[model samples]
Target chain A: MSYHLNHLKELESESIFIMREVAAQFERPVLMFSGGKDSILMVHLARKAFYPANIPFPLLHVDTGHNFPETIEYRDKLVEETGARLIVGSVQEAIDSGAIVEEKGYNASRNYLQTHVLLEELEKGKFDAALGGARRDEEKARAKERFFSHRDEFGQWDPKNQRPELWNLFNGKKNYGEHFRIFPISNWTELDVWMYLAMEGVELPSLYFAHERPVFAREGTLLADCEYIHKRPEEEAAVETRMVRCRTIGDMTCTGVWESEAKTIEDIIKEVSIARKTERGGRTDDKRSETAMEDRKKQGYF
Target chain B: MDNYDNMELLRFTTAGSVDDGKSTLIGRLLYDSKSIFEDQYDAVRESSERRGEEGVNLALLTDGLKAEREQGITIDVAYRYFSTPKRKFIIADTPGHIQYTRNMVTGASTANVALILIDARRGVLEQTRRHAFIASLLQIPHLVVCINKMDLVDYSEETYEKIKQDFEEFSYKLNVNDVHFIPISALKGDNVVTKSENTPWYDGSTLLYYLENVHIGSDHNFIDCRFPVQYVVRPNSDDYHDYRGYAGRIAGGIFKKGDDVMLLPSGFTSKIKKIDTFDGEVDEAYPPMSVTLLLEDDLDLSRGDMIVRENNQPEVEQDLEIMVCWFADRPLQPRGKYAVLHTTKEVRCIVKEIRYKLDINTLHRNEEDKTIGMNDIARVVIRTTKPLYYDAYRKNRITGSVIFVDEGTNETVGAGMII
Candidate 1:
């Protein structure tokens, strides 16, 4: 018998170990669910971490109110099927209560505004730990993120003064009123996530597969033509139905759609293996500036 | 895609300063392997051109943070991932400056291999010695020394041989088991992903080929059966009212059904009734695999308890001699009390004595001055409040290591390996 575990199995075990650590270490931990593939994978691992018992934590979703219709439907179905409690923190509620103001421009998105709502929800819930689905391979700033990332009382991140993490021993000790943003899938790559999902036969939203959607070109990216996005004068003429799929699931206003004919999980696996662009290449939120993700992360964006 | 299930994962660490072409070597690996997406490459190229560089500066690829990009130095460890058809690789890129010894140790803690880059123009520098010392101290299973910048020396075979010999002589004092030497030019992409004909005297495999085919299957400990319980799973539902499972990631050895195991700190013995995973029941489990074990008898157990084979029990002692690496700005005080975390157990420990500090650069023991400051490695004696079940760090990396947490600030200030 070969004692070697394949890359996917190794990754799975690592993630499960991290989840169990969080469950044992923190008092009130919450799994931050975004209805994306990474968050879906996190829920699956959480179930595996403590098999005999239900997921000991609630799933918090900071609803942007600009989500794809299919995403919300899938999120509700998954919450019911897994028997996990769902906590929604609405961005619209935060906006209506004068907690945050909506941005006004042709390219305005609620992506940045979700940070305020999330922090507020976490504070209200008194959650000691928030498990996110951020991967190191997704962006530049995330590459230096620790598995147990610490946040100050104000929910800000100080990248330069992070505690050194050694081996499998993670130091989750923090001061009062301060919390941690735990990333169990920090070591997984985009390809590894896809492979695991395929191997487990996990289901995803319909937006991930190819379909005819009305989209318009904005800065060479195909943005879904929806009521949430305030298109420019020139972009209005470019709206047309095309076969497309979403590489990443964000707010409908910011997530880019790829023009492709591949519709099945197998097709996606083959496409991602040889793809030239990164999954984040189509994310308009990262295109705001070279240091956009870094700045937002420092401000406590998931 | 067909071989995805059979692919293995190998993690390696690289240490170098700004001028050692560490960034260029990493960039070459990712680029040649087609792991760098077009958008990422375009961003790097644009940033390079804006700074008036002649061509795309590969050094900008690994520098992620804003301050690092501005100061032109890596302040912390950044992880990078790439893969060939045969294996997946994770690179823990760290700075080689003497001040960043803490970061280097953190990266080396989990690496299977260490890649030490030696500039060919400067045979073996003090920085190279420091990197080798840390890798050896961390007990990395393999080491690959790449003599970079062969193009600068006109691909001289004699120059490469002298550096290799000097490094070997110095490494003899360390505890490294496997070491390989390679000649390459990271800037010009020679012997990185593919073999270059510039050095006809060299007959070794390329850097990528060596990384892909390195023997790392035996790196884990399979002789001592040890499992540190992390959490206990109990469901009080009607269908399974009395189910109690001990959950943890196996630290070492192989545990099978019907194996007689002893619980640590309690010394109670029981037989393994079953091994459970998310998928289903399994007959046996090995190191690094997280699984739940059900004992034949309901024994009183909780977190911080270790389950090991009866015959291979670890040493349980309150007094420990450890090799300490200080990581905090505040110097380690004599007889200072802090929280020590080993495996799943946390206990308060006091520094009993400061055995001499080891000078990492010279590999000398300084017995006169015993002040342990930041980035200093020393041999110290500590006494914990409770006895800890552990092995020598060289025997089991997972079960033998510990971290000291500052009680006041709640920051991890030190890491120690059991001696």
Candidate 2:
């Protein structure tokens, strides 16, 4: 008596199918967990993908060390709950080791430096596939990404020379050292993510909800006043107590918090539906250049 | 009640030449459906103004890559997602040039509908026929012939009818099940999201209405039982001991507990003890469902194994006759060895012979043109190292399709549909 699946159900099933393919194809696969809503959703889907059994893959967190405290706590709790292995690739360690130099400025972030650390981690772990929460609708460059995006031995993404992914069949075959960056939720938009979150009742970091946090204004975006961010003196940004929430979570210096009264998932969905800009519109890292994402992706940033 | 209780999904691909307004039509669909957010619209507007276009170019919304925007053409396939209250749609927007035939095939392979745009003044062009033929080759369930630029033809019913008739006659060679025609100007927002007052004589559902209402439930094969085991789920933990579930997405037919099933390549028979989903164990499972199956007997099953009904089984042969759409730039070499990927099974294969190359324009077979180049469709015979379990593509799409991979480059060189 069953008919067609609803949109959310269809998306879930599609994601589950992809997750299973990753498990079945690659020998060493890892879920890229950012402790954001998108990555949280990825963990949820991966868990469901191998239900009645623990996820065969480990959760790799490319930790920038500029994370919100709540996100780290939630990430640890999630790992404990799922019993999935956690591997942290630290950007701070990369900076400390002088492998990647830390940028120094008001808009300085560990975002770009994450590629070197991530690639080093991937090589060390010998992971053949890294499942990400990247959605195409988030950025223009991402829209051109394939579900089974191949990365060379150097962990570089060739936007022009990607394999044509036809149908549900994703070609995960690659050379010995070359690997694939799998995006199961590449088709999901920000609003769809919210709708799915509300529908599934998935747990997320508390930073996503509205709270009175000390924030400073920088380039029309609200930046959380944290130790990781070094504000320039000329930049007239004073710490203010405003009801704010994060649309996306990343490095504390790059991820922006927006003024909002919407605290719950339903409220977030409503706000997202009527929101004028994309979720990345609030991100300062993408504002560095039009092809910022493309450039970083070329260097293997997940 | 869940918000997505009754929501469904629709996957469609758009095809047209450079100036046939394919990008504009997709833009209009997204724009009129309220899927276009302000920042995205503003970005496109900014780019349009920077390019010195007088009016805001809607096509800029889809030309995402910098090279595409610079050349003003879609170079590769880009997937777009948007939704209405009734349905969610995934649009596989592909380039229209003959050089990009591989892109069209890649996009159309998974789509339920093929939205082929035809310029009203130009009628059914060669690109239209090529797109329709590819849709047929891919077995896309629905073919939507959007007669775009109707405003250029004054929205004349006679013009629409003439083109529709020409398309129908041309489509006679195609194997698509549902054929629909709509005349409208995607640039003008007519009969796309709303009924056009200009086309009062035409009594049909709008493009959006048709997309939201198209029946896609029966598109998958449910009569033939075929399940390819993708992975074996084993939890060596203490809580649940000795739990072995075969994990895979059901390719065809339906399975219930206690149903008699047989494993391919091994001939091991087992009864379905339980159909497990993420939610819980379900009573029955059908095609395209990713689930775990707990069998009554503990059988040694691994990846590349197929599960089927006791009575019905797919063809197990080492040699296969298939129609291949070559994707690589290098021409196919006779007796060339390749890595064949079919239904989670990877096997070494060699080209046995080239039957004939298909002339996409004339629908004729040229037996002399044995050297198939990139984007060329030809009947090819292949011999695999091991016997592959599959059904004819016409009967079951999931088991029938296969792709040839270049072992050195690991690139998918050709897509094959078994006869």
Shares of reference contacts reproduced by the candidates, in order, are: 0.80, 0.64
Q: Candidate 2: where are CA atoms >4 Å away?
A: A232-237, B1-3
Candidate 1 clashing pairs, residues 3+ apart or interchain = none
Please give the lDDT score at residue B29 for candidate 2: 91
**Candidate 1 residue-wise lDDT, B1-419, digit = tens:** 78899999999999865578887899899999999999999999998888888899887888889998887778788899999999999999988777777888999999999999999998888878888988998999999999999999999999999999999989999999999999999989999998999989999999999999999999899999999999999976787698999999999999999999999878999999999987999999998899999999998999999999889999899999999999988999899999999998899999999989998767899999999999888999999999999999999999899999999999999999998
CAPRI quality band, candidate 2: medium
TM-score quality measure for candidate 1? 0.99
**Candidate 1 chain A weakest lDDT stretch, 10 residues:** A230-239
Estimated TM-score for each candidate: 0.99, 0.97
> Interface RMSD of every candidate?
0.8, 1.4
